[model samples]
Target: MSSTANWSYTAQATIWRCLGRNEDGILTFDRPVVIKCDYGMNARKGSLDIGRECVIKNTIWTEYGKASVGDYLLIGKSSEADPISAGAEEIIHIQRFADTFERNADDYALFTGGD
Candidate 1:
């Protein structure tokens, strides 16, 4: 596998760690953290799911750390300035370097999810 530092990141996004739901049944999140990543969208033309007539899949790659499944990812916006205005997508999957490999600064994480 190629090192993460070798890849060029063209976009930025903010990640909010999910702190789980509250007693009232509302989800709460921690402070947002900005990360540099390479983002792309794939158009699924012939999806079998009728509920999703048109599906667009979003994928992102960034340095491995501070993110996991169920976290909130806000694209094209920073939560520091206006956290309430932007809508966040929940992270469904995370692909990271295997533990079999040696630890290095160049390791990366791949995140897949979004409407």
Candidate 2:
């Protein structure tokens, strides 16, 4: 249940995992998933209505320190750019973003966010 090269889908999977759990440590996909946002998504409480030209990382507006989207601010020629770079981690900027946002094993942590 891990995604290596999928960003938006990975986020959606995160949403799924949030509401998924089963006896065998698997999520039972029995019905549609309902999500409530306490963070992230900009436009509405649980929606990110971005247009075709928006960058995801330039300015992710927040509410009380939590990110959210508002009205027509949803669309644009925006993009997500990561500026953190340590030595030996050049793979992130040059190799990753240049080639594409392909998340390697080290790109994530064992326990992400509150997981």
Candidate 3:
């Protein structure tokens, strides 16, 4: 059986791959790629909170090798859409794991981000 057979990847997102900065010290990204994954968001209390704009606690679980830190993620967006115009989320941290017997799934990457 496939390891990911029971996995629930219910969300769709676009990944803007980072391609290093330019001479002007501006980060650049390649074209976006659409992917399926499990997505979640939470509101946290902190000094950064302002009105209803609390800290965004975002979490995403997807196949390994899909994305990394510095890459941008636009949840509910597609590759053909403009990420900047649609509000893209930055990937701050990534936790990768290999499949295990208890959690029978393919190697996966967990992306956490939001300000």
Candidate 4:
């Protein structure tokens, strides 16, 4: 593990819980979702980058060399392109590209997950 007060890593992580405060109080809810991605921040520049398929809405917490809470994705443990989180669960995959490509000459598409 390279330690410079900043580092980068990828892992297959499961969304264990979604914490929120209701009338009762703070609580943890079920949000079992898994994702594989490449994510990290450039400590020097204070810049962060997420993979094409990884959509990070928010980061909950970071502890024990891992993020404890948040709705985000990060690089998986496998360096290979093979996806790690594969199963019957519903999953949405996102891929980013430099430019749009002609799908069938009749249509154009952008890989940025947006119109």
Best by lDDT: 3
Assess the local accuracy of residue 14 in candidate 2 as a C-alpha lDDT between 0 and 100.
14
Using TM-score as the measure, which candidate wins? 3
Report residue 57 deviation for candidate 2 (angstroms). 15
Q: State the C-alpha lDDT per candidate.
A: 0.62, 0.20, 0.65, 0.28
State the lDDT of candidate 3 residue by residue for 11-95, as single tens digits: 7778888788899997778888877777777445323223333344577777636677678887775755445555787776676
Q: TM-score for each prediction?
A: 0.67, 0.15, 0.69, 0.27
Model 4: colliding residue pairs: 10-75, 10-76, 11-75, 11-76, 11-77, 37-74, 37-75, 38-75, 60-69, 60-70
The reply for model 3, stretches above 4 Å from the true place, is 1-7, 45-56, 80-82, 101-109, 112-115
TM-score of 4: 0.27
lDDT of 4 by residue, 82-108 (tens): 222321111222222221232221111
Q: Write the per-residue lDDT of candidate 2 for residues 1-115, one digit (tens) a residue.
A: 1133333222221111122447888433222222221124222122123322232222221111111112111112222221111110100000112213332322221111100
Worst 10 residues of 1 by lDDT: 46-55
- The residue ranges of model 1 lying beyond 4 angstroms of the native Cα positions read 1-7, 43-56, 80-85, 98-103, 112-115
Candidate 1 per-residue C-alpha lDDT over 1-115 given as tens digits, one digit per residue, 9 for 90 to 100: 2353445665788888888889999877888888777777643442323453333356677764768777777766575633344576666566675433435544355444444
Regions of candidate 2 where Cα sits further than 4 Å from its true position: 1-17, 28-61, 64-115
**TM-score quality measure for candidate 3:** 0.69
Q: Is candidate 1 or candidate 4 better by TM-score?
A: 1
- The TM-score of candidate 1 is 0.67
* Every model: Cα RMSD to truth: 4.9, 17.9, 5.2, 15.3
Model 4 spans with C-alpha error above 4 angstroms: 1-11, 16-19, 44-115
What is the full ranking by lDDT, best candidate first?
3, 1, 4, 2
